[model samples]
Target: MTEEAQRRLLVELGASLFQRGYSVGSAGNISIRLEDGYLMTPTNSSLGRLEAARISKLDRDWNHVDGDKPTKEVFLHRAFLDARPEAGAVVHLHSTYATAISCFEEAVIPPLTPYFVMRVGRTLPLIPYYRPGNPEMEPAVHAAAKGAKAVLLANHGPVICGATLIDAVNAAEELEEAAKLALLLRGMSPRLLTPPQVDDLLTTFG
Candidate 1:
């Protein structure tokens, strides 16, 4: 996509997430990988009110080359992109359900549905708590991201990688739904998809 197209799409998707409450109060960031660099939401910008022309642009080396300043959490996006070479976009969102689920230390949501499995992958890595926007966590996140496309940051939220911006957003949304299902099913004996079923889904859709 052209830079203009990417910026417009980011504004649209970001607004969609914020309006529906996946993000609120300038609490999320989205970035798209470009052949020359990246297109990202500006720092302190509300996802709901992004200006396409003012979206931040960064060169491959992470320099801010145009538009507004990039998110302070740029390191978070870089970590996932560097670790997952095939990823073309990344999104970090403070969605309520997923953030609530992240508070737990070791709660891995089971594959309660096939869409969740296909979109979110088999394992959601839980990165130990790191203060948000702390570049110190980049190395740790980068290491964990190497093994999973979606990871829940302890007490923070989810950082997801995708083949495109929409893919990342869709996966993040699916994860939120999966977390909601897990919480709703708590204390009940919910039958999760078996290993072979999960493997089949991964093989077919991952």
Candidate 2:
């Protein structure tokens, strides 16, 4: 995507997220990997009112290439992009349901539903708790995100990677939906898909 197009997508998605109550103020961050560096939402900037031209750009070596400072979790973003060559965009959101699920001690998001499996694969592993932006979190995310499009940071939020901005957003949304479903059926003796069903779904979608 052109730089201008990338910037506009960030602004659009950022605004949509704030309006939908996904992340308030500047609490979340998003980024797109560019040919040279990356285009990212600036630190401390309100997603609801972000200006496209002022987005941060960071070089491959983590140096600021343009605009203001990048998000503090830049290393977190870098870790995934480094490990997953398919990652073109990354979104980390403190979406309510996902974060709430992340707070649980045994927060394992299973392949409860077919749609979740199709969109995010069969697993969204729970990375052990680490303070936000901690170097420790990066490795944890890397480990959990293997063979998965999304991973939940214990007591933190969800980090989703995709081949495009919209794909990343959609994956993030799916994580939130799965979390909501998990919470709603917390102790209701809900009928989770059987292992065979999960395997079939993964074969078709994974």
Evaluated at residue 126, the lDDT of candidate 1 is: 87
Best by TM-score: 1
What is candidate 2's TM-score against the reference? 0.94
What lDDT does each candidate get? Answer: 0.92, 0.85
Error of 2 at 164 (Å): 0.8
Q: What is the lDDT of residue 186 in candidate 2?
A: 87
Q: Per-residue lDDT of 69-169 in model 1, one digit per residue for the tens?
A: 99999999999999999999999999998899899877688899999999888889888888888899999889989988988889999999899998999
Record all residue pairs in model 1 with backbone atoms less than 3 Å apart, i.e. clashing: none
Tens-digit lDDT track for model 2 on 1-206?
Answer: 69898899899999999999999878889989998888888888877888988999998887898998988888778877887888899999999999999999888776677887777877777888887778867777776666677888888888889889898889888888988998988887788889899889879776
**TM-scores for candidates 1 onward, in order:** 0.98, 0.94
Sliding window of 10 residues with minimal summed lDDT for model 1: 101-110
What lDDT does candidate 2 reach at residue 108? 72
What lDDT would candidate 1 get against the real structure? 0.92
